[model samples]
Target: MSKKSPERTPPESLHLPRVGVETHAHLDSREFRDDLPQVLDRAAASGIAAMGQVFLGPEAYQANQALFDSHPEVFFLLGVHPTDADKFTDATLAAMDAAFASDARIKAMGEIGLDSYWKDVPPETQHRIFRAQLALARERDLRVVVHSRDAFAETLAVLDDMGFKDRPLLWHCFGGDEAIARELLSRGWLLSIPGPVTYSKNVELARAVAAVDMDRLVVETDCPYLTPEPWRGKRNEPALAVFTAARIAQLKGLSVEDAWRHMGQTAAKFFGLELPK
Candidate 1:
């Protein structure tokens, strides 16, 4: 009989925080459908003081609102994803506007922007919807969470053309290198790094995170996806945010506690949330 291989275990640091918050995660994801309570419990136990759920559509927005209402510790971002650009309509924008108008817990307008990775959604349509959402955010005076993939230049151009200079913009799951990062920093946009930074092949992203100023940086899990190493290919959750924080701490030459504290504070200020006393 062939010998079986031993199961790999995560490092001890995985369970210990140096400091962390999961700035963006999707609690409405099917991966957490069965054990959301348990997931949130794990997040709290893991020292995650706050979490932002990215709402993808009307259904997701409603579901996330209910979840956030049930768990005050969880916050949310309201927006339509670029892949769903074709779904944009007068009715849809009105619904989003109405939701933002009434929902105080909905912190920002995002996980919204351009994604040229999938050709299914045309670039022109994505640009149109993104501009519309930017306008909504400006009108509502809400911070914006942006998702730019394989269309960085165009994304920045739109922000410039739409005159979003004064608004607080968060570049979620940032994948660009130092040059792009510097450009964003110059424009006063914040960057949120996810689990991909921990992967061996993502040195460029890791460097970008390290190069960014702490005050302008935020950490995220982008859970149910981009699971950090050791847990790669496994379903991710907010608790995994610690790993990303730990790696960033290493890169920035700061203690885990300092990194987490800074990220938590930045997130709170950007999202206009009150930290638990």
Candidate 2:
């Protein structure tokens, strides 16, 4: 009989009781429907202290309301993504308001900036919904998670028009260069570094990681997408956020423990999250 090969284990650090939280994720995505419990357990084992499950819109809110309760380690941010701009309506806003009013589990408002790359949603329509959501966030006294892609200038302009400067903003999966990072930092915005930073070809991202103030740093998997290196083509889960944290540590000249703490604690404070002490 042939001998069986050993299963490969993930890269790990011996840092005691590490503080690694996935600041952004999509726990309700169909990707986790089959084995969410297993995924969350694996994340805990991988040193994930907490995670934020960002809701896409009304449909996502309906499907995801109970996920945060199921795991105390998981918090949520509710908003309409730019792709779902067409779904923004008075009824949807009512549902979002009810979600915030009824449940203290929801933390912030967004993942709601602009995505010009997917042109099917017209720029005008996207601007309208995005601005409306920003107004709602301000009215509710909530922080904002901004997602800008292929429309950086326009996205920045829109936010500027909305007078979001000096507001509590978390720039999700920041893909900009150091210049943009500097701009965001000047505005007192936090950046959630994602898995793409681990890629060999992303030198600029590495530079941005090094350039940003550590106080403004946080980590996220943005999964079931942007799976980090070594797991590039596979679907990602929150457990894998440690790898991204490790990469950030490598770039920032921080020990794995320190890097994890900076990112995780930054997120905790920004979202007013409560992780087990």
Candidate 3:
């Protein structure tokens, strides 16, 4: 009979300092409806100092912004996802604009780029909505968070056309190779590394993490999704970002704590949040 493998260490047992930032998460999703308080506790105990809670649209934002009322560590990213291009409208933009104007925690205009991975939305419609959001971000002078999937080329073209070069933009959920990393870095954009980097088969992402400047790299769980290795089959949470940081540390030849702290600091600066103490 084959021997059973040993159990992996729990994320809290990693003993990472509370200097990690989870740069992306859909905490508002119904998956956490039953036990969000516990999830937030786990995230805190696992050393996550702050987290970026992404609201997919104006409705989600308005409805769920109160969920984190007691958890000041959670910031916000508001955007109309490309797959929801059909729902993008003037009213949506107006809601987002009003939210940004009134709320200090809403830090960036993002997770807002082209996603051709699913063909439900037409490419033209996605492009049009993407441009509109980009223009809005520029108008508000807010940092932008981008979500590009199988539409990297088109997304880059749109960003370039809109003169986003050297603007404060972050490429969210970056699973690209070193060459792709270089292209974004060249435009002075930051890359938000995600849980998939911990997958053993993701060699290209490993190479990119190793080659990129550490200052330009940030970590995210994208959770309740993209759960990292050792927990790949489970629902991802902000606490699991420690594993993502651990893998990034291994690729970059740095201590996991250092990687965690640095990425946290980078994200804090990028999102205009106070650095973790």
Query: What is the model-wide C-alpha lDDT for candidate 1?
Result: 0.84
User: What local lDDT does model 1 show for residue 7?
Assistant: 49
lDDT of 3 by residue, 1-277 (tens): 9987646668999998888899999999998999999999999999999999999999999899999999999999999999998999999999999999999999999789999899999999999999999989999998999999998899999999999999999999999999999999999999999889989899999999999999999999898899998888889999999989999999889999999999999999999988658
C-alpha TM-score for every candidate: 0.93, 0.94, 0.97
| Tens-digit lDDT string for candidate 2 (156-258) | 8988888899999999998778988998888778999999998989988889889888899999889999988767778898877887887888988888878
For candidate 3, the per-residue lDDT at 102 reads 95
Candidate 3's C-alpha runs over 4 A off are 1-6
lDDT by residue (tens digit), candidate 1, 6-61: 34344344555423557899888888889999898888877777788888976678
Q: Pick by lDDT: which candidate is best? A: 3
- Candidate 1's TM-score: 0.93
Best by TM-score: 3
User: Which residue pairs collide in model 1, if any?
Assistant: 18-256, 18-257, 19-256, 19-257
Q: What total of clashing residue pairs does each candidate reach?
A: 4, 0, 0
**Could you tell me which 10 consecutive residues in candidate 2 have the lowest summed lDDT?**
7-16
| Per-model CA lDDT versus the true structure | 0.84, 0.85, 0.93
